[model samples]
Target: MNGSVTSQDLGEIFKPIVESFGCELWGIDFNNSGRSRLLRIYIDKTERPIDVKDCEKVSRQISGVLDVEETISGDYVLEVSSPGIDRPLFSIDQFKMYIGSKISLKSRIQKEGRRKFNGVLKKVDAQNIEVEVGKVDYVFPHSNIESANLISDY
Candidate 1:
């Protein structure tokens, strides 16, 4: 099918399928080209970092399943790999996972003149994130966030 399926549905379909093989599904991006399509899967694991073989294995297996199921009914390339250093903050758990680390959060709501906030992740509550700014902590609602990612330290 359709990509309009619930996020939970897509997650359900991919989670077990990937984790069953001992891999964490990082992301799934379904997009269109001029007349073609692309299905990219980003994966992760604990031990040995994702190498070529790891990506190959996941790509091959996932490709086989997607091919037979025909969820994407068009010409597409399947790409699988690690999240690298700059991974997307997907959930509250993920945000919690990076507490104390630097992050860049952007939302529709404006504060001081922009929608971006750069600060340390102080806390990741249920529906909002508390970021320490100056002497005050600003709570940002998760639903209003357009995107969030870790700020690399180098």
Candidate 2:
């Protein structure tokens, strides 16, 4: 299935496998190298950090499943790791989880010729992510976000 399926489809296929391991599957990145490709699987715990052993175990399990099913062919590097400090805010739940924490966002369409915003994440409801920038509150639709990451501690 090397050329048959897109990464999105493969991600959908792998989501359950990762979730079954008691990890939230943050994202998957596939980078093609000259000799091999890098398949990085980012995962995390909802309430705590993941350790090296956790990553290794998930790696082994995922490797087995990938090898058997052949999601992507050719020599590849499979790396299972944590999402780190700037974990992505992919869903409303993720946004809610980080409320009261500082965040940065970029949208698909520019606003005032700027695509970025940095502020304390206020609220994340079914409709949007609320962020307070300066003295104003901005509501961003989850669908319009091109990228979002937790702001690192100073």
Candidate 3:
């Protein structure tokens, strides 16, 4: 993809391919800051736990499409995998799915001198979510979240 291409664009490009494997496109993470760009595709299947074979299958297909499309201009590492236990939450709907679960998140901007929060997910709405850390409740706008993931006990 070009510099103007966003994760959303990548999502559109890859969603069909992922779904063809009987998986949901959980999310896409493209990191270009490092020496080598990394494109990570997270896939999920409710019917069964994803295995190595599943990832390999998706990777091979995606790689072939990427090569043919030349979506990415330069060399980049492509990874296709399950979200695992501590799955990253990429959408408001995802957060809603894990209500009452423990979660940790980093915000793009500090709130009350804190940029990181680890807490129980209390509530989720269209615009924001409420989390309880200790005895205090914090509300975070979805737009401010840089990253968030469920906190797994296992």
Who wins the lDDT comparison? 3
RMSD of 3: 1.0
Better of 1 and 2 by TM-score: 1
The C-alpha lDDT values of all candidates are 0.77, 0.82, 0.91
Cand. 3 TM to true fold: 0.96
**1-154 per-residue lDDT for model 2 (tens digits):** 7744555776787788888878888886677556777888888887779999879888988899888988777888889899888876667777877889999998887776788999899888887888898988888888788778898996
The C-alpha stretches of model 3 lying farther than 4 A from their native spots are: none
lDDT of 3 by residue, 25-133 (tens): 9999899666788999999999999889889998999999989988888778999989999999999999999999999999999988989999999999999999999
Off by over 4 Å in 1: 29-38, 73-77, 133-136
What TM-score, over all chains together, does every model reach?
0.80, 0.75, 0.96
Model 2 TM-score on a 0 to 1 scale? 0.75
RMSD of each: 2.8, 3.3, 1.0
lDDT score of model 1?
0.77
